[model samples]
Target chain A: MFNNPVTSLAHVKTGRLRALAVTTAKRASSLPDVPTAAESGLAGFDVGFWLGALAPAGTPRPIIDRLNAEMVKAVQMSEVLERLGALGVEPIGSTPESFARTIDAEATRWAKVIKDAGVKAD
Target chain B: MTSLRRMRCANDRLGGARVALVAAALFAANVAAQQAYPSRAIKIVVPFAAGGPSDVMARTLAQRLNVAFGQPVVVENRTGAAGAIGAEYAAKSAPDGYTLLLAQVGDTISMSLVPNLPYNFQKDFAPISLVGQTAFILVTHPSVPANNLRELIALAKSKPGALTFGSSGAGAASHLAGELLKGMAGVDILHVPYKGRRLPPLIC
Candidate 1:
C-alpha cells in the first residue's frame, strides 16, 4: 500500500508514509516533489493505477460516444478536477481510442511482467 | 395503354407517396428513439468494495451524469474476484447504454493473473474513456535502509531474499511491480501476498 488512492487513501494524504519512488513517468500531482521510478534509477517504469468506463460490447456507437463525451466533459470540469486532486487522483479525460490502447498496452505489459515474475492470482 | 401499364403507373405514383410518408414516419421514430435514450435511470457498476476510489469516482461522475442526462444515476458496487464479478455483471447486462462499468487496472491485471476470467477485458466491453489514474508510490518503513529505487535495489542485493514486500494479492499491481523491480534490478526480494490491501505491517 503506497500512494495509490485506491490503497492508501487514509494514509498517503496524512503523510504517515513518505514516497521513495512513484511508478509513473512524471511526478504525481498530489506529490509533485516526489521523483518518479525512472528518476530514481529504474528507467522506463511507468505503471499506474488507472480507471476507465466501459459498456457491453454490443452497445450502440452513438451511446458509447455520448458516454465518452460526457465523461470527458465531466472530468474536465473544474469541480471534478479539484475533487480528484484532493483524492490524489489525476483527472484524465482520454478518448476511447487512446483508452483502448492504454488498456491493451497495460495488459500486455503486465501480462509479461506477471509471467516473468511467476505471479498467480489468489 | 395496356390495363397493366396504366395500373402500374398509377401504383408507381401511389407508391412514391407511400414511400415519402413512411420515410418521414421512420425519421420521426428514429428521432424519438434517440431522444428517448437515457429516459430511465443510469447505473454505474463499481467492481470493488464501497468507499474505494473507484466507487467514489463513479459516484461523483454519476452525480454529474445525472445532472447532464436529467435522469437518476446510481453507483452499484459489485465486489468480488478483484473486480471481475462486477465487470462480468456489467458485460452481461443489457447493451442499452443504461448500465456501465467503472473498470480499473486490476481488471486487466486479473486477466493475466486469474485463470479463465469470466469476461475478456478487450472483447466483452466497449471502452468509453479513461476517467483517471492513480500514481502508485513506493514507500518503505523508516527502518528499511532505502531512500529511492536504486537504493532499494542495492539494499535488496546486499541481503538476497531478505527484503520482503506485501501486495494486495499474488497477482496485484503491487506484486507485479515488485517482481518487475526484481527482474529489472536483478534483486531477490520475496513477495508476500495479503488478503487485501493494507498498511505495511498488516500486509507483511
Candidate 2:
C-alpha cells in the first residue's frame, strides 16, 4: 500500500486510486470531496504524515529562527501552497518550539501504535 | 571610550537588571555569529533514498534556502538503517549552521520500531519548522475481490494467510500499518516487504 495519497492519487486518480477515506478526522483540504476514515467507518483512525526541518541539537538558536522564518515564508507562497495542496500536503510552518513539542507527542503516539500492533522490523 | 563607560554602567546594575544586560549582550553576539555562519554551501541531509517524499521535500526547501541565503543548499541522501543512519550522521555533525536535516514521520516511527538507536530525536536535533504533512493512503489492487475495508476484513478472515501484502521495506510505516491492521482486525495475513507496494491484513 502506498503510504500517502500523493503517490496513490497520482498513480491513477480516478480508476484504481479512488480515495475512500483519509486518515484525518476532517476531510483533507486537497481532497475535500473525499470522506474521512472515521466517516468511512474506521472511527478514530487519525494517523497523519508530517515533515520538519531540524538542525543539530546545539545549532545556534538564531539560525534555527532564521530557517523557521524562511520556511514559513516558503509555505505561504501561492505557488508552493498550490503545489503542496495538490500533492495532499498541508503546509504547517509551525514554530520551532511547537514543532519540537509535536515531535515529542508524535514519537509517543506512534510508539504506542507500533507497540500495540506488535510491529517488528523484519 | 563611551562603550567602555556604558559597559561599566551595565556592570553597576544590580541582580536581575545586570543579568538582563549580560543576556542581551550574549544574544546579540549569538545573532552576529549566526548571521555570518552559513557563508558556504549548506547541506540538508535526507535520511531516505533519493526521490522519496522526504528527499523531494528537502530539495524543494533547498532551492528556497539557496535563494534565501544566497548560498548553494545541497541535499545529501545518507540512506540506510531505515533512515537512522542518516539521522545519526546529522545528529553527530557539527552544530554549526552549515548542516540541516529534513526529518520525516518515518524517522519518528523508527524511533519506536528500532531499538537502541544511536540518536535520540529530542536530544540530538532541534526542529526548525514543520515543513508539511502527507497522509498515508491504503489501496488495493482492483483484482482483489474486496471492495471496502469491511469486505476486505471479511475476506481476509475467510482466507487467513491467503492474503499477502507488500511494503516499501521492513520497518517502514506501511509495514507497521499492516501489522496494526492485522492486530486490530485479528486475522492471519502475511506481510511481504519490499521497495515495492501492496500490504494485506487478515481482517476479522
Q: Which regions in candidate 1 have their CA more than 4 angstroms from the true location?
A: A1-16, B1-32, B202-204
For residues A43-105, write the lDDT of model 2, one tens digit per residue. Answer: 666666778999998988878888899888888888777867776788889999899888897
lDDT of 1 by residue, A1-122 (tens): 34464355345456565567788887886667778888988888888888899999987777888888889999889999888887778888898889899999988988899888777667
Clashing residue pairs, candidate 2? A1-B198, A3-B136, B165-B199, B165-B200, B166-B198, B166-B199
Q: How many clashes show up in model 1?
A: 0
lDDT of 2 at B167: 70
Docking class of 1: medium
lDDT of 2 by residue, B103-156 (tens): 987878988888899889888998999888876666677667766666776888
User: Which candidate comes out best when scored by lDDT?
Assistant: 1
True contacts kept of 2: 0.74
